[model samples]
Target: MQQIYLDNASTTFPKPQAVADAVYQYITHAGTNISRGTCATTTEDLVFATREQLCRFFGGEDSKNVVFTKNITESLNIIIKGLLHSGDHVLVTAMEHNAVMRPLQQIGTELTTDNAPTDAITFSRIPCDADGALRLDALPQLVRPNTKAIIMTHASNVCGTLQPLAAIGSFCQKHNLKFIVDSAQSAGVVPINMQEMHIDALAFTGHKGLLAPQGIGGFVLLESMIDEITPLIVGGTGSLSHTEHPPRFMPDKFEAGTLNLPGIAGLHASLSWLQQQGIDKIRTHELTLTQQFLDGLQQSEAQNLLRIVGKRNCRERIGVVSISTDITDIAELAFILADRYAIATRVGLHCAPNAHKTLETYPTGTLRFSFGWHNTAEEVNIALQALKEVLAHGL
Candidate 1:
């Protein structure tokens, strides 16, 4: 059986050939650490080149401002833990993942068991509509004088609803608050411009929409934020091994220890591929597939067997679709699809229980089927047919 993978939102599958080749080339031939003037291969040059590539891909003004980390979760931790102080407050949406929430909980006024946080960071949650759109009207009311930043996800990992970044940026500007974005779900799948969007910092992952290998992601921040954020991890940066103190420079201030050269190589190649393909073309293809799936689900909604969990239409949404059904347990359905139909999907809260609550699918979450640049219309049709068959058998 040909297994159909529909979990791009978790981590993209079937990465482009160039990405894999780049990783292989780095591991096989240039299997050395990156330090300037250290290796004849100029491995540092390749690393810096990838930094520049990522800077350009994400609309960062300078390559030096790009800092690498293990993944978006770590990037977010660096931002949340390094920047916000004892009196600082932040605003986040209801759809944020554990990457953001877990850190915020540990830092803020919330009570936690393991860690005692010195930073008394407080946060407010901006509610979302039934369709998973942020309630921007309620945004103004939630702002406190202590609100230092707004950390928002560009796209919901669960429902794929695209947040209003520009409008939110405008709001942040008016409120004199920093706009920090988590672009894990949107980095390569959608266009993001830091300057145009007035973003102070943006975190991204390579394994998802960027179509690169896992274990490498980073954040780009404006030069002004350099002084505001403290480095989470402090160690050997190669540039400043002389003194025990971490480097005060842009990326060195945030990045410590050895970098993931293999993942960087893969990301570098993926960025080039995305540039050549153009995100507009890629986004259109994914949207076309999403629209196809939504149309089929909508036509069958009258049966009361399954219902979409987020925006009914295709507008302002990614290719991630969450569907909840009364026919059978979503877990069982997912297993049947995988075992019998050879269709793989993600089922559960998707690490965003609040998002499920907003979509009215909490406690019992939805079965999510996400599409990628490689997925075809045929795959969408197959998924729809498989869903019908599974639900029919349950009935």
Candidate 2:
């Protein structure tokens, strides 16, 4: 039986040929640690060049502002921990993944000079509508005099609901609050202009939309915010050789230890491919597939039994669709779809319990089918047919 993989939101599979070739080529020929050598024409230069490529890909104001991390989770942690102090207030949406929630939970109320809690670090969550789109009108009321930042995800991984980022960014700029975007789901799939969007920082993963291998993700900070935040890790930045103190600048200030050269090389190639193909074209193709999936789901006999999550309109979303059945176990249904129909999907809370709770799909969760550039209309039809069969057989 032919197999179909629809889990791009979790991590894209069958990465682009350029991504594989670049990783293999780097490992075979230029396998060397970066920033430890003084030679002008060394592996370090190649690695740094890859970083430059990433910086350019994201429309970064300065290439030095790009700091490589293990993944978006690590990058989010770096920014959340480095920027938030004891009394600073943070505003986040109800749809954030644990990557943002867990860190904020650990920091508690305040930053203090004596390492004692001074004031509680207050946080308010902007609620989302039933369709999973953030209620931006409520945001202004949530902003306090002490509001330091507003952090939110660009799109919901579970439901593919795109947020109104430009409007929110404008609000942040008008309020003088930092706007940090978690672009794990949108970085490579959507077009982002940091300057025009008024984004202070952006966290992104490489494996998903960038078509790179796993283990390489990063964050881009605005040049103006570099001095305001400190490095989360303090050791071996290679810039401060004389002292144990971390460098007080971009990239080196945040990036410590050896970088992920292999992953970066792959990402560099993936980015090159995206630049060549044009992100607008890729987005249009993915949206077309999404529309096909949505239309199929709507017209199917299983529509009455299945509840689609998030907004029904494709224009306000990306290439993901999540559905929950009224009377069937989502996990069991997913397993059957995989075992019998050769259709792979993710069935769970998708690491955002709060989001599921907001959507009222918690505990039972939902079966998520995320699309990619390579998925075909026939595969989407197959998926819908399989779902109808599963509901008929199981429910």
Candidate 3:
């Protein structure tokens, strides 16, 4: 059986040839560090060019404001731990991943003198409708004087519902609240202009939509937020060895330790490819596959074979779709899809219990199918047929 991969939300598979080549090229030849006064193959100029590429792609004001981390989770941590404090309150969407929720939970418990925030952080979950769309109008009731920032995901990894960043950014602007976005689910596929979105900070992972390998991701923040967010990791930045403290400046301020040169190199290539392909072009192709699957699932739903958990349509959403059925256990269904049909999928709470709760899929989770750039419409049809077969005939 031909293997069908439908878990791009976890990590995009069959990455662009350029991505792998870039990583291999770096590992094979250009083994060098960024701040330790770079070597030939990997220069400070080359890495800075990657940052510049990201800045241009994301519409960040200054390339220096961009900071690299191991992944988006770390980027969110640096922002959450750096910006929020004991008495500070934040607003987050109900569909946020543990990357955002867990850090907020872990904060305020530890009292730090100068490194990180010690005060316990409080937050209210902005409710999402049963379809996983954000109820942005409820923002007024959730904001407080202590509400320092609004941190949220750009797209739902579980259901693919997109929250309105422009509207949320407007709300933040009107209230003077900082806007921070987790773009792990929507980075390369979605067009994000920080200045236009009024986003103070945006975190992104390169492995997912950006088509880069794992262990490489970061964020870009406005210069104004520099003073507000403290550096989470402070050590050798290779820039300022004179003092024990971290370099108090952009990039180095938030970026400590040796940078992921290989990941950065891969990201550099991926960014170039993405722009060459055009963001709108990628979204159009992925959403086309999404619609094909959604339409097939809708037909299956009409026959009572399965139920789509989120919006049946692909508007204002990415390529992720979740389905539920009373026919068999969802996890078991996923296993059967894998074992019998070679269809890969993810099934469970998906690391966002609150999102499950919001979508009324808590306790029992849905089997998730996510489309990607490499997925063909024929593959979507095959997966749909496989779902129908499993639902109709047990084992």
Candidate 4:
């Protein structure tokens, strides 16, 4: 049986050919540890070139500001833990994933008491609407004198609702608060111009929207903010070998030990492909597919049994859709669809309990079908038919 995978939000499947080729090529030929070897001149060039490519992809302000981490979670931890101190207030959104929430929770715990290790970091959550969009109007009210930064997820992983980043960026600029964006779900899939958006930092993952392999995502800091934040992991950063102290530079300041050259090489290739294809085209294709899926969901009788989460209009959302049904257990229904129809989807809280709570799908989560550039209309139709069948059988 053919499988229809709709779990791109979790991680993209069938990554671009360039990504696969780059990974294989790097492993086969340029298999050398970056910044460590003296004779591997070509490998060193490849590493630097990959970094430059990432910088270009992110709008090319400074290649040195981009630091490769294992993934967005690590990138976020670096910024959140490195930049935030006790008594420093952070503004975040209700739509953030656990990657952002867990760190902030730890920070909040630390700020409350001296014994709490992280007592210095305080935070306020900007509530999102039922559609999972952030309330931009509330931002001004939440900005306090102690507000050091505002961290926001560019798009909701659970619902794919896009945030008003430009407006938020302007607010942060006017307030002199640092603006950090978690682009795990939005980068590569959407257009993100840091300069235009006035973003101070952006954390992104390579595997999902970038169509690169996992274990190769990172954060890019603004040139001005690099010196202000300390490195999360301190060690050999390929520079300042004379001293034990970490290098007081951008990427070196944040990046410690050997970099993920293989993954970066793959990411470089994937980004190159995206550049060639153009992100706008990819976004349009995915949006079209999402529209097709929404239309199918609306026309089907299954719509009555299933409540689609997030914005009802496709214009306000990305390529992800979450649906919950009162007729059946969402997890069980998801399993049935996968087992019986060979349709793979993510079911449960999707690592964002707050988002689920906001949508009132907590405790029992929703069925999420996340689209990708490769997802076809026929596969979406199959998913709709499978959903109808599952409801017919179980509900």
Model 4: per-residue Cα lDDT over 147-252, one tens digit each: 8999889998898899988899898899999999999999988888888889999899999999989999998878877876778788886677889877787677
- How many clashes show up in model 1? 0
| Model 1 C-alpha lDDT per residue in residues 70-140, reported as the tens digit of each score | 99999999999999898787899988898999889888864234544345777878999998899999999
Off by over 4 Å in 3: 38-41, 108-120
* Model 3: lDDT of residue 312: 85
- Please list the Cα RMSD from the true structure of every candidate, rounded to 1 decimal place: 2.9, 3.2, 3.8, 2.6
lDDT of each: 0.88, 0.85, 0.89, 0.85
What TM-score quantifies how close candidate 3 is to the native fold? 0.95
Give me candidate 1's TM-score against the actual structure: 0.96
TM-scores, in order shown?
0.96, 0.95, 0.95, 0.95
Q: After superposition, how far is residue 252 of candidate 4 from its true place, in Å?
A: 1.4
- Which residue ranges in model 1 land beyond 4 Å of their true spot? 110-119
Which model, 1 or 4, shows the larger TM-score?
A: 1
CA shift at 244, candidate 4, in angstroms? 1.7
TM-score of candidate 4 on Cα atoms, chains taken together: 0.95
